[model samples]
Target: MDEDSIDHNKSVIIDIPTDLESNQWSKCWIHRIPRKLRKVKESAYTPQLISIGPFHHGREELKAMEVLKEKYHQKLLQRLPKDGSVSNQMEEFIRDSYKEIHGRYAGLSNNGFDDEDQAFEKIIMRDACFIVELFQRNDSKKESDDDYILSTPWLKKAIKLDLIMLENQIPFFVLRQLYTITAPHLPSVNVPITQASNHMNPFLKLTCSFFKDHIVKESDWEKFAEIKEIKHFTNLLREFWLPREFIKRRNPQQKDIADRKYLYSATKLDKAGVTFKRASKGTSLADVKISKKPVLKFIPASKGMKLKLPELKLENDTECLLRNVMALEQCLYPKEDYICGYVALMDQLINTSEDVDFLVERKIITNMLGSNKEAARLFNGLCNQIPREKTFYARFYNDLNKFYENRWNVTRSTLKKVYFKDLWTGSSTVVGLFVLVFTVTATIRNVYLRHL
Candidate 1:
């Protein structure tokens, strides 16, 4: 080797120690969306009105929320005891462990703050308290007359969307810690608190309540009753909405994802004798199933089939919510990227406005976006830059593809479309067939008679 090359190798070896010392993979839960994903639809992942965490903390567009955050923080302080023990303790803890706090986010810039200064403490406390107070105030029966966010319906919804974005998050532990310290001093409004130390985690309750309207049709409290851990809002959303099957640890030896084939579009499947049914409200998005049914109850075997899909309510912020959760799965739980899998499967099923129209007609998709083409585009865009090498829906896709490939179903569907389009066409076809049969029978009879 060249002498200079040997020196370069030695320098590289020496640099490895410093890199290893700074790496904090264990603490990282908050992550920046990969550039590839961000480029697909940057607005989907970017916070629109507010920044909850350090990633987009100082953007000029979001600075307006900073004033409100400070106002909320002051309100949170007023809720605390005058003795100020909890505040002092939290401040000291953040000051001492600021590096640990900063390390929770991967690729976070220093932003010119060295160690835990007053600026850093203000940022952390304001952000954390702002969230807690927002939730608590929203939970209150009597909304404050002067409360700008709550009074403004559109702004309140915007803030909710902002909070759920992937980059706009702090470590969940920070929020919990702040809430735990202040819970005793704060008055519990809607949820009665006999003592501050209750068995139920009020922070979780409030968090779930805050996001209840957007994510699910069921009662969030009942669904997440036995909740144990949460990393952040994004993580909570992923866990709450993920299929029950993928919530558990995935088996590595499951079928290879490469072998998975995309299912036919909704319109195509409908034309192939497949019936689309909106799964019950209790059904998970990942609970998609393809079942074969007899055309008649009396018949033992038939080509009739049904595909059940859970109802999905798409709205203005639905893309943001889903993109962030999918980004979280991509970064934190690559192997168990069930949300990604679900969206990708949907992307396959929706190729055009016609497919969206079919699903909407079936009640499988509630198109609040107003246009079927827009809904179709949203589904198609979701899987951009999403890896397909592993998915929770491989088996489901395999089953769907197998069902679609059945020639009998296609032929039957074709025959139905051509011969029995409606009562008029069907009656005409039957009568024509009968006439042709009669003519053939008479011709055969006359030929036999003449031969005899």
Candidate 2:
């Protein structure tokens, strides 16, 4: 645990086919990355969480990646222009085929189902997995603890969660992970992102926790020792996704912005990071003294004593302790999905809309036909559903006493007054209501579970 030895085994290396000059890394990227990221540990640099922006930290990077991807797709179009030939005598045929595909896509319209929340979320999840995999093999880091790597998915749940993310990109990783002698052997695949939804196979969404002395909790770290799916994880990164850090650097920023919540672009390098105050670890629940007595942790609120955990509570008991504890499931909001899509739509609209004042002017969503109007509608709908204001230990609280008290009423009131009905009409209104209800329910559920 000594700070001096934290660099042990941290070197990493990445091999790529580069047509550029050999000295290019230093010239092109050295100034961009921080020193710590550039350090030659056992093999490569340690990975970092790619966050950006104030209220919406992860948005910029992912959005940039999406834009870059679309740009690449267009470039591909340019490579074989609408009239380009595939074979000696296939010029006309290929052009016709391209035209048909383009026409079909165009017919779908901008308001099509192409930009669903699930689709956007899938992009983020895949990108996260890509970053994880990039570090797993291409960039290996030395360990500070012979015990656990701070960044790797050493926990069973983390790994499984990542695998779920992986399925969106490289289906082969799933196949290989499932069949490989080493089940966790994540590998790369040349598969397209839209290749298969069947990749959701074995997409596990489990909610189980390890009790204080439970083996499942204790052994969560032990699973990483198994050298299983490194390759599978690696390839999935290389093919369909790029490192979060890569995308993070390219994000656009607002002028004159600075806030604790705001995450600026991230850069990786072989240098040390700025030493902010490390989160305090000695703050213990049972150690807080009450009435001049060292508290060894009693159930907060005498009522908690009556409520036993689900596994141990009685079924016959009316105000069942198990049910009370079980009622504590957390329902998470897909804030990223909602916000990302909203931002993208807003960007598109603001950038290309013929009329900017229409939304702020009439304020009638239905009457406003600009794409941004629909976008603003969707954004407000989701904004209404997500938990905006803060909650209190509540955040990372491990104990039941420090529970969450939601500020949902404020958010609800905001939604109620927004005049959503004006924006989404008829069938769209109904669908919006349904989605809003579902999102609210899911978010409440997620919070309850986490707090419980």
Candidate 3:
């Protein structure tokens, strides 16, 4: 063969590496819902009104929001000093931080763009500015009927839900960086950073305000203030709801329990002499505990013993919110699946409409869906995309099962429910027993008299 042919053949054969470091394969936390999971409920995973991040950036349906993003960007520029021409400086900052911002997203390099660096910088600047402005608007005290998003209740609600989706997120660091530069320029009334440290770190207060309703207590926000690194809004939200003790106790390498058996439903537990009461409003949902002793003991004790459960407010948007959070946990923190564990526990407690009704009556659950069946379906559907695991409530489950299996407790509960349900029924039973005893005595006396 000629030299050219030989060289071509040699070039075609190349050696490939067989191994790589785990870090090389690592992916970012922001991710699309796996197709297998998304198929169960596509709408729950989708953004309806707006898209915040690259996952759904250029979809035709979401294009309208781009105009709004540009409008917000213009407003952000207006905040800067007119003589300084700070827009150029801001653009330069984005351009310089291009690689760092791009690295925050997984598989972004694979997506073909006309000019990747310019496109990325533009996206990051526009999105971060839009978010900073939107949060400020939400946190503002004064009412403005002229504002479109806040004035329309449904619009505000939709935007809030969209902002927390797993795929629809920008890195929290990026948003914080943009806010640091833009905050000083905003109107004095708009920026509420009175303290120096707070001025340096303003996003925390803005985020807390945006999620005020979910916060169980005022102190919860203070707890969040101590954390230095937050991945994104959804992750922050998950952390916010977690008990402080649980957060401290979490060990990523700890062994996960392999038990996957189903626990008894609320109604079944009730029938087995386990009563339910609402837990304190400030308690974390994951901190469900069963009391070993009865809450109350009268001279004549009640039939069933009670368990204190945390109150859960169910609304129309609850399912959507929970499903997205669960998806994020499943994808990002499978080992520390706090949200998943809580949902699994709820699933065990609520199997049917009757279980929901029992919880609603006990105030353990507030149903705003207008029907118990709807609430049941919402809970039952939440676990469809995620696999069941040994939940944090495993101890409660074991204790409840042991309590239910005791024959004496079961018998006592059944008797109390059947024979002495109310005061009138107990009075009738007592009267009947007295009359029977007297009749028997008179019969015996007559027999004795006859013998005499």
Each candidate: how many clashes? 0, 51, 1
Better of 1 and 2 by lDDT: 1
**Candidate 1 lDDT tens digits, 336-394:** 77778789889999999999998888889999998999999999889889888766667
The candidate that achieves the highest TM-score relative to the unseen native structure: 1
Report model 2's TM-score to 2 decimal places: 0.18
Per-residue alpha-carbon lDDT of model 3 for 1-452, expressed as tens digits? 99999976654432111233545224466766766678799998899879886778788899998898888778777778887656777777788877666666655553755576677677778888888877777666553255577778888778878888888898888788777777777644343443422633677777776666753244456556556578988888777666556666554434345343577899888777787888786676666666755424663443345688778889877887788878887777777777787888888889999999999999989999999999998888788858765556666667777778777777877766776779998888789889999999999999999999
Report every candidate's CA lDDT: 0.77, 0.26, 0.74
Task: Write down the lDDT that model 3 would get.
Answer: 0.74
The TM-score measured for candidate 3 stands at 0.83
lDDT per residue (tens digit) for residues 168-250 in model 2 = 22323322221222113333322222222223222110111111121112222222222122222222212111112222343
- Residue 129 accuracy (lDDT) in model 1: 89
Name the TM-score of candidate 1. Answer: 0.84
Query: Which window of ten consecutive residues has the lowest lDDT sum in model 1?
Result: 191-200
Q: How well does candidate 1 score on lDDT at residue 2? A: 100
**For every model shown, what is its TM-score relative to the native structure?**
0.84, 0.18, 0.83
Between which residue pairs do clashes occur in model 3?
275-305
Q: Candidate 2: list runs displaced more than 4 Å.
A: 1-125, 135-139, 142-287, 291-452
Q: Global CA lDDT of candidate 2, please?
A: 0.26
